[model samples]
Target: AALRELAAKAPDAIARLKGIGLSGQMHGATLLDEAGAVLRPCLLWNDTRSHDQAARLDELPAFRALSGNIVFPGFTAPKVLWVAEHEPEIFARTAKVLLPKDYLSYWLTGRMVSDMSDSAGTAWLDVGKRAWSPELLQHSGMRDDQMPELLEGTGLVGPLRGDLAAELGLPDGVQVVAGGGDNAASACGAPAISPACRARCILSAPISCTALNG
Candidate 1:
């Protein structure tokens, strides 16, 4: 609805657009059933209902070693685990899983692709290699088939769906670019990633901070 409203406001700009970039909250678990139906409401980045699951995953050395981050309740992996434990029927029916923005990409392009920056927060990607980790997926009771194809933020995710493009007043050839998570996208926009930078703040649904070092 918001997207439709935005597009309605600028039909000229929408028609001129060559590509659309997506950026949304990181670590959100958007589960999909075998038929591509949403299983339930997305577990957002700030949801902390998976604290116990996060703690259990955090204790596993492989998680920290491979993902290069502590397993937080706010991450997608633990949230999925929480769903598996609490909503067994939904977990059993889940055929695909995606972060919020990536899910949008799938809806737009009919392709399941995700950017490294967003995948990193899911605790399922091997941060060093910038790819999905089989071991981590196994640990989380997920499979590679359920994950989206990996892509760099700059990579193209193909053209928008023909129907959607028509509805949104966008051209048929307008491609969708794989984009980073909210905070990572913000960092890209801000000039705070320099080595000398000590700290940076982000104000959003949940305020956050980033620290840097030379």
Candidate 2:
């Protein structure tokens, strides 16, 4: 139904869709196994069952240095750890971890990939350097192989799957693009305005306040 709506709104939807830009809920963990099957319902960014794990990770100097951010109940790393400790069987079988938008893109394109900006919020990437933090992954009880290949927000994600295009009643090979998290995506359009003022602000997703130069 949602797919139909997506098609309905865009005339010649698939062909007209030059590229897809998604702004997913940051920190939501979507675990998939080797077969590409979802292991369980995603623990969304708002879920707080991992609060204890987040706090424990916050005190780790190594994590702080690598990620340049503190672990929070809403971040992906502790959510992964929480699953590992409590849902051991599922965690054991998990072969790929995706952010929310990446999971949607996967279902659309059958490709497992992520974007650097979105990955930054996971507490598993060096935000300053824009790459996965191996040491942090190790400490979080996650394997390096389980992560999706990261891309920049502007990177190409190739064509849309033929079947999906056809199903949506349009041309094949519509291009896709890697996208960023809510804050990062929004930041792309946020005007600097004036040095003393700000054009935009994101309440969550790092709670950052960037003071732009006029």
TM-score for each candidate, following the candidate numbering: 0.89, 0.87
Clashing pairs in 2: none
Candidate 1: give the clashing pairs.
Answer: none
Q: For model 1, how does the per-residue alpha-carbon lDDT over 15-113 read when each residue is reduced to its tens digit?
A: 678888999989999999888889999999889999999999999999999999999999999999999999999999999999999999999999999
Q: Number of clashes in every candidate structure?
A: 0, 0
Model 2 TM-score, 2 decimals:
0.87
Q: How large is the C-alpha RMSD of every model relative to the true structure?
A: 3.6, 3.3
Q: Global CA lDDT of candidate 2, please? A: 0.82
Highest lDDT: give the candidate number.
1
Evaluate model 1: give its TM-score: 0.89
Query: Highest TM-score among the candidates is held by which one?
Result: 1
